[model samples]
Target: MDETIAEALRIAEESFIASSGPGGQNVNKVATAVQLRLNVFALRLSPPVFGRLKTLAGTRMTSKGEIVLTARNYRTQEANRDDARGRMIQLLEAAHKEPKLRKKSRVNRIGKEKRIKAKKNRGTIKAGRGKVDW
Candidate 1:
């Protein structure tokens, strides 16, 4: 576990609920679904990282700036809990990375000429397919 993510997890809140799916009587008896909520604004992330995190969270983020994640794929509560925590860690790690800056690329003269020539050839072919003016 990363220190940053671990620190975030320290403040995270978790709850368990009954999962809806096939699991015989055990599903009704056991609360396997884990819901993890983290307050993004509470974390000590920079503004850029926080902005990116909010974007990446999409609908998972609440108006209060909390990110909620649910995991119910497993039959056991521990597994589901681990799954949810793993997902949060992954999200945090992605948000931690700085996005690559895009460089402006210029088309060379030969490339420009080739593109123009291709466009002209395509136009000529299309023109030849039309009804003859004669």
Candidate 2:
């Protein structure tokens, strides 16, 4: 299905420029890391979607209910930012998906009959294996 940008549900946030762990001058000079944040409670999504987002975000969601995503794999700031935004979009989309309801499953008539027939055959074989007393 096509997805439209959810401007109404959009969240504005900031990201800091920091070094990518232990690297020399290149890493220190270039801020390739991206950190994306969105307050779940502030989102305009339906209640069910917000609840599912809370569960899906797991530890990424803060105690106050904020969804955070960080992307640092890319070398450029723009690329990293896009990656983070894309991930957030995917996460929200997943949360918005309709959940499949569980339907009670009954034993199949054909399979049940086959299983019983096999059991009877196995029982006869076991009976023949019993001690042959007088």
Candidate 3:
């Protein structure tokens, strides 16, 4: 019931039907599109899974946090269905993975000291270019 995708793996429903493809003049009449619907809000996924999914899905996630995938590449019904399912699995697996945490690091002391020293030297070099008071 959370925003995570663990709920997706638990409650995923696959519905693959014949696709409408380049099957001659009669292909346009058939329904060949593969629609992969992951009910993200229905399942109780972990916070990490949900976090990953939100990042992976980008703008694909609906306003309510649901993900809808549509596959209509192949002209054949079965091929299109398989392609859609494969893509859905890939997306889900990616979302299931945990991202590595960033480790904090300190600024290099030597680098900082060199920067200050260089600035002072540059100012001295510039001052020597001024006109003499005499």
Candidate 4:
């Protein structure tokens, strides 16, 4: 893992709660769901990365700038904890990538000609649909 991501994880807060889904009696008794909260602002990421992280987080990010992730797929608290950490790492890695700059591309002459030809053909078909004046 990257140092920054490691550092971010170091400061992240984690808690466990009872999962609502399967696992029979164990699910009813034990807290297997993990909730991980990370303060985005505290990560001190650059503006672009932070903006991307916020967008990627969507509703998971609270107004207070803390991202909350829950993992309940497993029946064990440790499994869920690992799952939550994995998800956080995935999110951070995604946000860490710099977006590719889109290059302005002009339509090639052949493509433009093909488009015009198609338009003319469609226009001819439409014109032929009119009632014959004969």
Best by TM-score: 1
TM-score of 1: 0.88
| Candidate 2 global Cα RMSD | 4.1
lDDT (Cα, tens digit) per residue for candidate 4, span 66-106? 99999999888988899999999999999999899999999
Candidates' TM-scores?
0.88, 0.76, 0.62, 0.86
Query: Per-residue error at 76 for model 4, in Å?
Result: 0.7
Ranking of predictions according to lDDT: 4, 1, 2, 3
Q: Please give, for residues 16-115, the per-residue lDDT of candidate 2 as tens digits.
A: 5774754467687877687877876666677887788888999998997777788887677787788888888888888889899999998989999999
The segments of candidate 2 whose C-alpha lies over 4 angstroms from its true place after superposition are 1-5, 8-10, 21-24, 108-110, 120-134
Off by over 4 Å in 4: 108-110, 125-134
Give the Cα RMSD of candidate 4. 2.3
lDDT, candidate 2, equals 0.76
lDDT of 3 by residue, 1-134 (tens): 22333455446555555455466664557767777777776755678877877788887778877777777777766777678667766787787766688999876999899999999999999999999898
Q: Return the clash pairs for model 2, or none.
A: none
User: Model 1: residues >4 Å from true position, as ranges?
Assistant: 131-134
lDDT of 1 by residue, 8-108 (tens): 89999999999987677899999889999999877878888898899899999999999999999988989899999999999999998899999999999
Q: Per model, how many backbone clashes are there?
A: 0, 0, 7, 0
**How far does residue 73 in candidate 1 sit from its true spot (Å)?**
1.1
